[model samples]
Target: MMISSQKVKVDPRDAKLSMAHFYVAFTALALGGLAGLLQVLVRSGKVELPYGIGYYQVLTVHGVLLGLVLTTFFILGFQFAVISRTAGTLSNRARKTGWIGFWIMTIGTAMAAAMILLNEASVLFTFYAPLMAHPIFYTGLTLVVVGSWIAGGAMLTSYIRWRQHNPGKPSPLLSFMVVVNTLMWIVATIGVAATVLLQMLPWSLGLVDTIDVLISRTLFWYFGHPLVYFWLLPAYMCWYAIIPKIIGGKIFSDSLARMSFILFLLFSIPVGFHHQLMEPGIDPAWKFLQVILTFLVVIPSLMTAFSMFGTFEMYGRSQGATGLFGWLKKLPWGDARFVVPFIGMVAFIPAGAGGMVNASHQLNQVVHNTIWVTGHFHLTLATAVILTFFGISYWLVPHLTGRILTKKMNRLAIIQALTWAVGMTFMSGAMHAAGLLGAPRRSSFSTYGESAQAIEWIPYQIAQAVGGTILFIGIILVLYIFINLAFYAPKGEQEFPVGEVTDNAERTPMVFENWKLWIGITVVLILFAYTIPFIDMIQNAPPGSKGYKLW
Candidate 1:
């Protein structure tokens, strides 16, 4: 006997949301790309801008819009899909709340961008303590955070309601990502809100003359770093769950996939301090503690990457893909989502692995606050994280529009991915070299003397600019391809109906719910954090103390 359950087709209306969100994300990328170009122009002396305003403003805009708005809404779409599926019915309330959240967040994001443009909130989206912003900036940011909080809440409620009705089966993988993202946002934003309410807002409103800056930055990074993972998890979910299915394979280990998400939720939170490793005042031992946890945090990423690639290789061989690298050819190269991760893998080997070295306390000192750090993150964020979003867009668009994507558009997207990979790799590597040579980041001018005493290397900065130009072109191509696909692609093909394909075989029902696994991981991980407060006492210095510096 065979079992059957109803699966709703993806709604055509959701296409509007996906397309709208895509515009936001892609436009943000475009602005960020322009920032890259400006940096190059300044460094190369190709064109002189009025002030550092051009670069800094763009940088601030790019980071906040891309990091907060783009990622948040895109993930919201993914959440909608999951809610529609696993919940058996997508609630009208969730649908409405999501759209409302989208609009509110968009307004907030625009205000935030305006703040940067007007130089009101150049504090960076990290919104560190004591560095107050204009009231509109904070208000705008508050709206954005609140909207996302509501959106996340809606998702959690939907999932919970669905699980209550569907009891006994583990939630589907897509839904699981939505749930995890919601949990992370809830946990992540607590710090952001606290910083805004207790620190930045108070100071900005003239309630306090001076505030504790370290505490504010500490809380902000706590939100910021894991928030990176929050954005990336949706893409990883697609990688683990959908990409394999597209390639005609099953997940290598469902349990491992579950564990991976659980670990990410737990480990990513406490380790944000790693980003501040080079700052003064923090104890060396505490910094070292974060460094160790940061390294430990890489385990889940490696595990997920290995598991996903392993699944692909196994399927490629099963489909007669032949030997080691031969699976490369056997992949569904025509599929954009499939190719995105394929290229993502190429970058991660260098970026992700090298990133581990960069995260090390000693290595970070060498590279801290340098172009190397920028390169490391851009590779990971752009190559792996943004690539995943593009992949999901490919999958979502047609499903939303009830149309099949043109093969040409998919091919071009792959080209864009390759271009981005090449560009980011070169740019980031140059930045790393510049950093190692003691070239500072966030500076519009190096002014290296003839001896190059203060500014050791200028050429690498120029290299970054050139590489950034390549990235700019790549980003433009991506946007152009997507725009054309949405507007120009003919609607002749049958709508891509959502459901498991014929090749999707019957599998045993999900019987195991190892809540203990996650709980255990949480307990073990906190053992590492338990020593944070005491770290200064034992090391004889608080974090950021003069004696506790990494550099």
Candidate 2:
């Protein structure tokens, strides 16, 4: 059975809250997309800021708005809508909690963004310690995290209410996925929250003379790696449960989907050390252990890939298609809803491969801190995740707004997705090639005093500028689509696609809902992975350094 509130439409009140989030998310996309374009132009040495704007400043705006603010708002808003659709309308208390969380997050967003624009903070997305910002910047981001926690609490309350009402019956698949992602986010954030509240805030405010740099970075990565998964799982939600419906297919296995999510919640946190492999003070023994755990994550990723392929092939066969590759021809190539996310699905192949290379100690040494790393994340988050998000908006925004996606708009969306894919190919592809030739990531344009190797990177940088221009066009199309869908599309009901599991699929086990078991095992794994390394980092640490205001 498909999970639903048994309503033909999302409650208007619930949708109001969701639309509030969309307004902010698209706004962030516009500003951040422009910042990104400027960045590439600067790097290509084709343009310079006329009024003394710093490259790092633009970089911070791009990272914080797109990476932090936009993703969070969209995921939370989308999750809230799903919970309402699948479980039931959120109760008054839950709705209020969601509203409060949104405002707090919005206010914090302004604070942090203000600081970045004023050049008060340029620490980049990592916010590594010893590169301190004003206290309000940290405080603002803290509020963002706190607001998200409150929003997550709203989700938990809804999930718990569903379990209480439904008894032994299985939870809705969409609802269940939302719960898992929220739980994972809360767990993953503890590391970053601790670093900010206990470490960065104090040191920045003069409560501490010097900060422990190694510990700060370790704590951040503890949150950082899973943070990547946090961005991804929503895209996975669309792939697992939603995309099957979009392509006119049944979900391959409900139990398999739940199991993979459980596995992800377990494996995602303990493996942050893979990101820290290049840093000093970590033991090789522990790094090796974490690397092994990191590989365990690949199992769930493969499971997702298998499920997708199975869904596609089975649907094609049912449509009277034959032979090994006929399924490819059966898919809805003209439908933006399918093709856009399908593009994301294809991008993840290289994205996932690059991730594995980065996880290896020997291979990481080659690409670590290089533009290749930048290229890798751009494919994962920028191409794979963001494209999937745009695909969701094609139906979701219309469904919520009581509008139909005009055919013209649909064709435009397809063009938008292709433009983004092509742009990323040029930009990220150049980044990888240049990085292999020893080009660095995160630095602004320079001739490096005309060194031979530095000169090797210029052509690639120009390619990136060209790609950036194309991507900017893609962003504009998406924004125009959003505006039309929200206010100007012909008024009509649009269906929100939700996949039904195959009749032959095994029943979803109640064990998947044993919160005590899953959360307990997750805690155990995190403790086992980090306790020793953290103790080692602290006990024999070298003298700390005072904060730097490099920006």
Candidate 2, residues 418-484: lDDT per residue as tens digits? 9999999999999999888878889767636367876778899999999989999999999999999
lDDT of 1: 0.69
Q: In model 1, how large is the Cα lDDT of residue 445?
A: 60
Query: Residue 445 in model 1: shift from native, Å?
Result: 2.5
In candidate 1, what residue range of length 10 has the lowest lDDT sum?
A: 494-503
Cα lDDT, model 1, residue 339 = 86
Best by TM-score: 2
In order, what lDDT does every prediction score?
0.69, 0.91
- Residues 387-499, candidate 1, lDDT per residue (tens digit)? 87776666566556655567787788888888887888678888777777777666666344455544446577667777888888887887787676666666644232222
How close is every model to the real structure, measured as TM-score? Answer: 0.88, 0.98
Q: Score candidate 2 by TM-score against the native.
A: 0.98
How much does each candidate deviate from the true structure in C-alpha RMSD? 4.1, 1.8
CA lDDT, candidate 2, residue 278? 75
